[model samples]
Target: MKRIVMKFGGSSLEDGDKILHVANIIESYFKSYSLIVVVSAMGKITDELLKASERAEKGDQDYIKSFTEYIKDRHIKALKASIKREEVQKETVKSVNELCDELYKALTGVALLKELTPRARDYILSFGERLSALIVGGALIDKGLRVKVLTGGEAGIVTDSNFGEANPLMEATFYQVKERLEKLLQDNIIPLITGFIAEDQYGRITTLGRGGSDFTATLLAASLKANEVWIWTDVDGLMTSDPKLVSNAKVIKSVSYEEAMEMVMFGAKAMHPRAIEPAMLYKIPIVIRNTFNLEAKGTLITDRVQVDKDRPIKMVALVKDVGMISLVGGSMVGARGTAALAFSTLAKQGINIMMISQSVSEADISIVIKREELSKAVNSLELNMLGKGVVREINYEDDVCVLAVVGAGIKYIPGIAARVLNILAKEKVNVFMISSGSSNSLSLVIKEKDSKIALQKVHDEFELDK
Candidate 1:
């Protein structure tokens, strides 16, 4: 039997009904394929966990106590609704309570300490997936399937000690994961693993950052050499553009791994950008499908692209709520370490630069980052670069957005850039900064107020709806 990994996002497992729906899907595929199912926490549970952790760190014991009860009650309610077998329900609820009890203790420690270390934060946040995994496994068992639930770390995914955003040491991970999981596969047991949570070398709990579940799925696919990885989410697949912005935005039936990465970087929410790296390296194909709409063929992402002259531009992505900071100085002309210093300073502050452009004269460098990090980025730059003559003035605009056009053909096509600029110009949208790359993407910064208009204009100009 061919092995395959199926990952269901939080939205797909929102409640008891949804969990049953996912279980049914798994049942349909179980006999034909040697299956591994990775699942995220049921709807917004992670967010609630984070919020509760924050409250605990603020010494809000009352809120923490209530939130603990809320979590326990919620999971138990979902458990009762999903697992009809009394034995399964009793056992699963016991496991859920034990986890919830542990959660309460952790929150109490945070309340007493009033400090949320990265390690502690990761530990607290991990409960979401841990509890969900137990519930999901129990449901599957209730259906008479041989199910064994494991956390990402228990499944042999080992990463560095970066508590909140850990990265797997892939070489060791690939070997260890295969060695551990293949046995279960041979025994005809379904390995249901928790997504987003992994352990570091020191045996400490860590997270893979936002959308880490997708990362987990791809990593498993590459490790197991699975036939394919399927990511079941709310959306049909990667779209020509966000449907809210472009009413006629069509689902991209096929896209290259590189193009999908570009799209994700420019605000496509179908999958995390890092999730594709392992699959791409190993040449494993991934399919993004809608759990709700089974009829939709969805999107196929692979190492190769089937080029079509009619669809040169595969996607138009709009990244909103971004701020651009321009570091200007006369001494910056031909300056070697200026850009390096600026970037390093922000790195220390944990600020991620989304887009960057430099003047041809080399006198200024403009970087775009998330709007919420604007103040910290500006302060870090000012304190480090000011009075050194490296950066004379720092100007920033928080009300801006980035528009990106991505396709494998962009690198080979000549007039695509000109046509893109023309579309923005024709719409009277002021282009603040532009960055075109050989990586099959052309990005432009524009006023956030004009984001919708710009997206619609680009979508229509490319005739993506057709």
Candidate 2:
């Protein structure tokens, strides 16, 4: 059977009208495809829920109640507005109420204990996707399409015990997804599936961290071996440069899996970096489309694309609000297990090294981490390394951005990095460090303030706007 998974973001279903619009879009594709529809929480609902959890953890019960009430009202209102039928609306409202009750139970526990466990927090935030899926399913049913809502767990997306960021257990999830979803498809029923939130082996709720929803959808696509996966969002699709930062930014027609991965890793917001992995592994095509403008031919991501031989720089990307830390020592020269020790220490501390560069002389090794994790990474190095004689000096840099040039066959193409550097030089943007040939990407460490102008220059110089 020909099948496809379509995933929509919160921005595409933020309001009642937006939910209805999504329903209409789904209805248009209803009969023609065997579909699995995944949706994010409606708007900033997840953020609000996370904030409420934090406040509850800190012993703020009043704000928890007020925020929980607002969330309940918002989802219920959207559900009612989307499904106008009295009977269906009432029935769906009951489900919404039940979900809200469940959320309250979870939140009340957190507020009482004045502590929020990762497992508990996952359960609390999961209500966003669950509620959105239920409301969207209700609307679809009202439109005369047979629909059933399922959470990521119910849809058979099992993951490890990594509370805030769990990796899916693919082998188990595959069997479960095919058995459940294929049964639904055979019965001519559409699955309004929740994304991002999955259950661990112990049946405890776990979330797949940032961009988890998209990861959920892509995971389904890969497991079911779907023909394609379409990610519907607010923008026109992947652009050469951020449209907000560069006015002349234009939508890329198509991108190879490697290029797309590089772009996302370097801060392109169109899709999650890991979202492309499953599809790329299986050679399944992924499409990025705009919910508001469905007619436009959005970018297609696949295993390979015919490279524009002349313009090796497919995209210029930037990541802001990052911090860099370096460990330097003469003892580091030709040292054995030094890199491994540093990596192991950071891993134990749960610190993600976004980028790593080591000196050829082995005297220094620098890593870029999210600005928020800088303090933690530093403290970890100090405690674990300085006293233990892992290194002599630890240095820090903040207010930096990572700028990358991504394209397929970048290494094979001569002078690509040189051209990028020349463009930056002409624009007078200082480069702090450079790393090339890191999985189809060449990145430069630069000041955050220079990101926009540097991107603009690279975008124009490469004629990406054309």
Candidate 3:
């Protein structure tokens, strides 16, 4: 039988009703294909866990106790509401109690120590997924489907010891996951794996960063060589623009991997770039669907796309809450390793530059990064490159955002860049920086105050809403 992996986002599994809905979706596919289910924590459980850890680190014992009870009550309540069988419900509640007790002890220890290491933080954050997986598994069993629950590590995903934002050691992971899950499939049992959290070679728990759960699903699909991967979220699919920003924003039916990567890289919040990488490498197609609007055709991301001749621009994407830094000096002209020096300086500080543009004269270079990282980036650049003669001046603006026009058809159209600039110019939105290349997108830094208007203008200019 063919195999498929289905991943549900936090929004899809927020409560008992939603969990039951997801179980129904799984049951519909179970008979047709050997299915594996991956899920993230319900609602804002991860965020709450993060806050609870922070509180514990400050030695807030009372809050820690309250938070533990909150987690326990929430999970147990959902468990009872979703699982009808008394025996199964009791078993699931027992597992939930054990996890909650462990969570209380862990937080109490942190409270007493007044220290929260990255390793400890990852461990605490993991309970969200661990508890949710058990509750989901119970719901499936209540529906008469044979279900097994396992954390990412228990399911055989081994990563390096990065603690937080850990990356899987693919070769080992591929071998182990296939060996472990293939048998479960043969027995007609579905393994509902906890997403995001994994273990390093040392058996310490770690987490993949944002969009980690989707990353987990895609990674598993690539490892198993599944025919396709489906990502269930709240939205209809990838939209032409943020629907709130553009009232007419429409779902994109299909896009190439490159186009989707560009959109997510340029700050399309609906998806993340890392989640697509594993599938792209193996030429596996991924479908993004809406759990609430299952009838919608949704979006398909594949290896290639048929360029739309009528509309070369597919999306108007925005990355808000960013800042731009400009470095200028006459000595920078014809200076070898000047850019490299700047890059290494920022790299050492662990600040990621979102977009970069250097003039042909090589005298001035502008870089875009997260607003919160601007101060550190500038300080590092000033200390490493300034007055030592290569970089004479450093300037920065924090209230800025990066806007991008993305599509596979961009390169095929002549003067597309000029047209985009003209559209923004008409709106009186000052462009701080521009970076366009052979890549499938043209990115520009603009004042955050103008983002909404700029996004709307560009979306309309491209007729992307159509």
Candidate 4:
């Protein structure tokens, strides 16, 4: 039997009308395929939940109450409008009550203790997906489709107990999911599934990182050996550049998995960056389509993307407002564990290194990180290396832009660097740092203020709008 998975983002399932619209899409797909539907939180609920956790951790009980109540009402309105059958709505309402109450209790505990554990945080954040699945499942029931709501754990997505960014145990996950979900499919039951939330082997709720719904869908696609995974979002498709930043940005018809991953790593939000891995490994194609514009063919991403050989540059992706820290000292030359120590230290502090460049002379090494993690990364490095004479003074900047020109063709083409720099030169965007050579993508660092203008120039230079 052929199988396929469809995932809807928050924008596609924000309210009752949106939910009904998505349900119709699902209904249409279910006619021929054994369909698995994965849903994210109904618009902005996950963000609101994170805010509630932050406020609760600061010992703000009043705000916790207000936050939880607001989310509760949001779900209630969605459920009331989505499920027409009274009995189905009644059962989903009960599930919603239990989930909302559980979230409230967790928030209350965080307020009283003034601390939120990774476990508690994951548990609190899960209500969005939980309620979303139930609402979606109930709505499907109204259409006379047999449906069941499964949380990530119940669906057998086991992971390590890494609270905020849990890694799924693929072997166990595949075994458990196939054992249970395959049976449900055999019985002609559609699984209306939650997306971002998963479970550790310890039976604790753990979440895949933000934008994990797409990851969830791709994982299932790999496990089921599905023909393809469809990720429905708000945009027409993956564009050469962010249209808001570059009005002439064109929608790319197709791209390779590697190119897509590079674009996402450099902040293109095409889909979850990790979504490409499992699907690629399993040789499953991923389709990015707009739910509102269903007729549009959207973009097809495969292991091998065929394009004009002359123009291999698919997109110039931009990461704006990044910060960089350079550890410079001649005395640090020839230090063996220097790079390891610095990176491991940042790892321990949970700071992600976005990019890195080191002088061949070993006089200095600079690392770029997100602006929000700058303070923590710097403070942790300073405190840990205060006495260790591994390096010298640390100089950091808070405003930098990262531009990644992604495509496999980059490595094959000559003078790509000259062309890139020439475009930047025309835009007067000085490139302070460049990381390239034997890389699938060329990364350039520039002033944050010039990010948009620089991107437009690069896009035009590549003639990607054509």
**Which candidate number maximizes lDDT?**
1
> Which candidate model has the greater lDDT, 1 or 3?
1
Poorly placed runs, candidate 4 (over 4 Å): 112-114, 344-349, 375-393
Clash pairs, candidate 2, are: none
lDDT string, candidate 2, 1-466, tens digits: 6798999999999988999999999999978888899999999989988998998898887887788789889988898789989999999999988988888878888888988998888889899999999889989999999998988988889999989999999899988888888888889899878889888888888899979999999889888889999999988878888888889888888888888888877777688988888898899999999999988888889887656767777788888878998899988888798889889999998988888899789999988888998998899888877855659989999889899888875767777888889989988999888888554788899999888889888888888888
lDDT of 3 by residue, 1-466 (tens): 8888999989998998899898888988888999999999999999999999999999999999899999999998888888899999999999999999999999999999999999999999999999999999999999899988999998889999888899999999998899889899889999899999889998899999878998899889988899999999998888899888889999999998888888877766556789899999999998889999889988999998667777898999888888899999999999999999999998999988778899999999999888999888988888888778788899999888888889877788787888889988898989989898556888888888999999998888878877
Give the TM-score of each candidate. 0.95, 0.93, 0.96, 0.92
* Global fold similarity of model 2 (TM-score): 0.93
For candidate 1, give the lDDT of residue 373. 97
| Sort by TM-score, top down from the best | 3, 1, 2, 4
Q: Native-vs-model 1 lDDT?
A: 0.92
lDDT of 4 by residue, 218-319 (tens): 888887778999999988788888888889887889888877887777777558888789999998999899999988898888988565666778888888
Candidate 2 lDDT at 393 equals: 87
**What are the Cα lDDT values of the candidates?**
0.92, 0.87, 0.90, 0.86
Candidate 1 per-residue lDDT, tens place, 224-321, comes to 99999999999999999998878999998889999999888887878899999999999999999999999998999999976567667989988888
Off by over 4 Å in 3: none
